[model samples]
Target: MTRPRLLPVPLAPLPNELIGSYLNRLADANRLPIRRIDALIATGRHHSRDKDDLTGWTLSSIERLAALTGRNSPALIHALPSLAALAQPNPLPTPPASLTPTAWKTKVCQLCAASRGVHGLAVQRTYPHQRICLQHQRWLGGRQLPISPRFHELIRANIRHRRLLRGHRDPLQPSALHDEARTMTSRWFSNNNGPLELQRTWDDRLQMLNPDTESDPHDDRNLIEMVTYPETVVLTTLLSKPHNPVHHDFLAEVIRSFGLDPRSLPALHRHTTLPSSMRNPDTPSHPSRHRPGSKSTA
Candidate 1:
């Protein structure tokens, strides 16, 4: 049997009129975490500067909420602001406590229909303010999608058409974060380089082949890539083998980048003419050698 059709619940930033119309909805399906909702308002104020819609919404929602509760929503919200309201201590609370980075990510993804993706989840510094995820960053049509493009655009455009045009003019609020991320994405950054790390994997394979002394690091990488090497062809063959189940997708790319066969890692692991203490640490160290900046061999 087919599964029952689930109705799509409309996301919020719902207007005042619709909110009143859906007042019973909030009362019945009070799935809204009041603390979280309040925290969201506080976050808006912190990030949006003078342009805070949620605070206005909160002021109104609280008023209406309080009238329903036979108390005051504004007073209650003010008297006991959510953790997001407390600006100094913690940037943002993680799962169960407030909002998990994952939950925030999933929430943004859902809101945007995941056109790109929700970034900023990985950016630890700006807990509340971070880039869109790799998924949401819109590179194609040439628009840096803002956090609340749909939500804020409607408001900003209505408020000032000259300022907020649709994906037309300048970036909504220019941010320097991506510049920093791009500048940082080079060489042996743990996240960037896979082959450099293959030092261990290559060593393991060579050890299994001969079970001999630790192969020179340079020699090892070289052997792995060497045209003269049989093992060099082995992994490549695994990908092309008709009988093999998995494709060597990455291996193909590696071969192309490193060439059909490359230098042996033996030279890589070889010690320099000068002692370790004198070497420039910024330079990549060979196996059994320390990078220069570290506690020198002195």
Candidate 2:
């Protein structure tokens, strides 16, 4: 059968949409086999940027896609902000093996995938700094799925850190922060002990978000990710300077942004345990002076 003059679908720039996704959807709507259409497109001799199985389309490929979709190339490119960097081909040089770094890679948002009828994990969705989808107001739940609520504060902290980087105040990238934050959180949680009520409060909050049977709400991995993610993000911000304020009022502002309380959480134990030399006796560290009787979210 002959290919139709052009696909009729419009390119929707849903958050972090992948080029592979757009192509497959286009193929599905056109009632043509993906491999066949892909092969035909390959014949156009366009530039290629392949990521494993998915090809990160270049400007030339976008033009080909535009011709097939009956859309303007410039308009299509404008819609995909993520691809703007690729418009010009100044690829980075690979670092030597000794200098290569690695950490937990980014993953896609489940809600974003399901909306497009994508299954078994959609596109990579690998923006490490983006743990919570502020747009959709959901947690990224590790694998391509949305877990539940009760993480808005953590999400807010994540957004604030990103804004800091955007404003050029912080020199470290999200990946570096990711590594340090985990280290700090792990050490703090393992070394310090807090009130039992505080521990229970955290556990109960996580339980409310966990899925039913089969997967334990108290699973070690889930707890670690949920706890460390926000802690590290907040810590990264505080650690920006050699010394961070240990005073309850300032600490409260930081924790409040994470939807947490300074008085009850174990994660904040480090600030409490600092040497008296580090603490200011004049500034008390307990129920926040900013707002008395504010309940802890976790």
Best by lDDT: 2
Candidate 1, which segments miss by more than 4 Å at Cα? 1-46, 49-185, 188-288, 291-298
| After superposition, candidate 2 runs with Cα above 4 Å error | 1-4, 13-15, 43-59, 74-86, 91-126, 143-152, 169-175, 183-202, 211-214, 218-223, 242-298
Per-candidate total of colliding backbone pairs: 24, 3
For model 1, residues 186-272, the per-residue Cα lDDT tens digits are 111223233443444544544543345765523442233211122222222222223311222233343454543334333322421
- lDDT tens digits, residues 1-298, model 2? 2333565554343344455555555666667666645655553322211122324445555566666777775666565444556664785675433222232334456666667665433343334466666667665645433435556666666787677557544333444545555564555445444334435555665666654667765455546566556666665565443443443344445556556555654445433433222245543433233123444465
Candidate 2 residue 121 Cα shift, in angstroms, is: 7.5
What is the Å distance of residue 156 in model 1 from its true position? 39
Q: What lDDT would candidate 2 get against the real structure?
A: 0.51
Q: Using Cα atoms with residue i matched to residue i, what is each candidate's TM-score against the true structure?
A: 0.20, 0.56
Query: What is the lDDT for 84 in model 2?
Result: 55
